[model samples]
Target: MGRHETISRRQLVQVQDRFIAAWGQMGAAWGVSRTMAEVYALLYITAQPLNTDDVMDRLRISRGNASMSLRALAEWGLVSRAHKRGDRKEYFIAEQDVWALSRKVMRERLRREVLPLLATLHELRDATDNRTEQPAGAPLRLASDDEPAPADARKPVTAAEVRQLNDRIDSLLELVQTVDRLGERFVGSDGKGLRLAANMLSKII
Candidate 1:
């Protein structure tokens, strides 16, 4: 290669390395697997699909790690399989559209994290609803003189306290439901809703 072409290639390689590392860090923050994010970043920047060997070579990851990351990325809809004519090896490609990619990520987060949190909160709310019907022998019983309760005897939970806790849970549930609804609207269909919503918000802002 000519000097100019060689320099350009070297610069591109540097940028790719930087991006892969940065993306992996971001993925860790987002609770995604770092190797998976790096693998996706590599494929995202490359012009052609890469098989398992190519991915391992580029990222310096073991065969098992590369395979697992590729499988996970595929599960998240961030990567897809491709075949070259006359090639038996399975190659992978990343989702190139930024909007679609973001929507997919958000959808997974809503499904995996937000929904489960909401369910747990609902269970807590139910548990707190019937404070009065607490079993006969409550843990926080105040000791009488004859019974000689412990010096550190604590006051039992009251109906008012339960009501307050229930109300707080309700408030949190409302907020989380709003988020879930908004996430649903943003991620529905094939990426159009997200783009339109973002564009409209940008214009308003």
Candidate 2:
């Protein structure tokens, strides 16, 4: 067992304040609300689970705002609920391990954002392919074997444009799929692969 050093009240407050502010900024970049990120940051640094009133008071947020933020964090699996032995009020705690928290966030983002966008891209590609498969207007075969065809052949021109558009869409779809696979690998293997990569990079630098 290791001995624990006592942290002064002022030092603890300062640390918590810094974490909350920095996390609020990071939260926006991560596509989550600043308040939600602050709440998680506060919970993460606290040694004990915090009740709703405690969170609202410390964060200087309205009860509704704290409640909603906590709920969202819980939904994302970044925060969890706790119950004190004799207390009827609910308490919440944040997941403290940075790597695990990040993995959860990435997993949720892949499910909510990346996967849906990929599906939409697939639909667009399918629609474009269907349009390209059919003749643009009608067959443009010459009536006479020796007759010179019209300079403006609408059929070929339109078909070529449609095929070109479909090809572009196919390329975009492939890029998105590749990104999706990379995300899966990053957060997969229970985050072991990610940790290993981070360790290797640290040594290389």
User: Compared with the true structure, what per-residue lDDT tens digits does model 1 show for residues 1-205?
Assistant: 6565445877899899999999999999888989988999999988579999999998998999999999999999999999999999999999999888999999999999999999988777766665677786755332335865677848888879878888999999999999999998888867477778878999999
Worst 10-residue stretch by lDDT in candidate 2? 136-145
Candidate 2 positional error at 142, Å: 32
Candidate 1: C-alpha lDDT: 0.88
lDDT values, one for every candidate: 0.88, 0.86
Candidate 2 lDDT tens digits, 1-205: 9998999999989988998899899998879999999999899888579999999999999999999999999999998999999899999988988888888888899999999999887776665565456677644332346866677764554878888988898888899889889888878857466788789889999
Could you tell me the lDDT of residue 203 within candidate 2? 98
Best by lDDT: 1
Off by over 4 Å in 2: 1-8, 131-157, 199-205
Model 2: how far residue 159 lies from native, Å: 2.8
Segments of candidate 1 deviating more than 4 angstroms: 1-7, 130-154, 202-205
